[model samples]
Target: MPLYQLNETFWFPPVTESLEDGLLAIGGDLQIPRLLNAYKNGIFPWYEGNTPLWWCPDPRFILFPDELKISKSMRSVFRKNIFDFSINNAFESVIQYCKITKRNGQDGTWITDSMQQAYIQLYREGWAHSAEAWQNEQLVGGLYGVKMGNVFFGESMFSLMSNTSKFAFISLVQQLKEEGIVLIDCQVYTEHLESLGARFISRNAFIELLSTNI
Candidate 1:
């Protein structure tokens, strides 16, 4: 139950204490080995400012590829060819954009300088990837995350235009479907993601899936 410093790799008991809460060890460098191990163990880094906090939340939000909702409006948006999607095309740019973009109720950003550098490193090593949405050669929106085996751990996403991020996500999901991916780890709940068909699963269930899949 003790919260440790950011330099530690393992976490304490997850805040919720659920098996999925994954409050294991914490305070470690976000080096490739450490990050890979963390994801393999169902742990992920999520901290504000300079602290490199890691987490495993109970009742994690996830979206199975087949469960993705393609509402009529979204379908119409897709048909418009408003954006082009690519993978691992602009990983660092996507992360940097997500860090700088403003979110409702948030002035500063949780994606600190160190975190950006860390994820950039991950991308170089092929452990991380980005789904990019391009508008006439301009990067409008995208997302970045880690992929281990068949599971993708979503880190963050951003959009500069309406439905851009959604297009990137839908494209990523379709690609994952082609690659036989089964699960996407959303980490926490948000109505936006929920609206896209992401649903909650107990941390225990999440860990079990990670153990078996990743």
Candidate 2:
């Protein structure tokens, strides 16, 4: 199948049209409405270099709030009060750090200046949110993502202090779950997230979850 190139129409092709590796389209601007629409349909934008690639993979990575795994050590960290947590309190700092935080085997961040600004706009509009960890009122770690209805589309996370990002995430997940959030879209897999009980589900099943949950 040929790849679709997005135009100013501000819509995405059906997720079934995605390529084998989940590349559905390219060239869409990251406007808030487009981003929200993409997320509502289980599609999301990730850039490779400068081109924005939208995807909805066959095996979507996700976490059920009730299935969250907080190991003895993670619990111990909480018991010890290792970090303080808040939501949406340090949105720009969290994302800015996620942009600059170096990861092994990665050169440069995918969160370009434009992408950051785009999400910031979403933040202002109340669709994007951040979960932050603080130490002595200094931002240590956190994550940012798009939240709609009962779904959260996680974008990126970073940690400056030990296990602080995980701390922030676990806290946020528990809070959202208490308030009726059922699904968390991890988007792709990572061992770090796997430890916290994120797993894969079929794209079709994921879409159904979105249909009912959102």
Candidate 3:
């Protein structure tokens, strides 16, 4: 199938037309309206190098707030209160950290300069949020994602210290649960996320969830 090329209008190709690898369209500007529309439809941008590629995977990875798992070891860490958690306090720093932090087997970063600037704009518009983990009065780890109503579409996370990202994630989940937000879209599969109670649902089901939640 031919990859769809986006025009100036805030629109996306049908998610069912995505490549087997989940790449659906390319060349769309990451404007606020486009980004929000993408997430609301279970589509998101992800690319390395220059081009902006959009995706909607067949088996969506997500974690319902009530399904978050905390291991005994992490429970112990939580008890220590060794980390401080903050929300939307350092959006720029969190994205910068995620941009630089190396991922296993991946060269360069998907979060390019334009992407960072766009998300910063999203934060300013109250559509993006960050969860920061601080230790010794310095930022250690955190995550950032776009929010549409109750649905949070997680983009990336980074940890300067072991288990710091996990701590921040757990904290975010608890707070979101309290706020009556249940669905968190992880977007893709990862062993790390699976261990934290993220599981796969059919793309059809995922789209249905987004329709109802956002």
Please tell me which predicted candidate would have the highest lDDT against the true structure: 2
Candidate 3 per-residue lDDT over residues 1-214, each given as its tens digit: 8899999999888899999988899997888899988998899998756889999999899999999999998999989998999999999999999999999988888999999999999999999999999998899999999888788889999999999999999999899889888799999998888888999999999999888888
lDDT per model vs. reference: 0.83, 0.93, 0.92
lDDT of 2 by residue, 84-121 (tens): 99999989998999999999889889999899999999
State the lDDT at 31 in candidate 1. Answer: 75
Local error of candidate 2 at 82, Å?
Answer: 1.3
- Quote each prediction's TM-score: 0.91, 0.98, 0.98
Which of the two, 1 or 2, has more TM-score? 2
After TM-score superposition, the amount by which residue 127's alpha carbon in candidate 1 deviates from its true location, in angstroms, is 0.6
State each model's C-alpha RMSD to the native. Answer: 2.6, 0.7, 0.8
Q: Rank the candidates by TM-score, best first.
A: 2, 3, 1
TM-score of 1: 0.91
Model 3 misses residue 178 by how many Å? Answer: 0.9
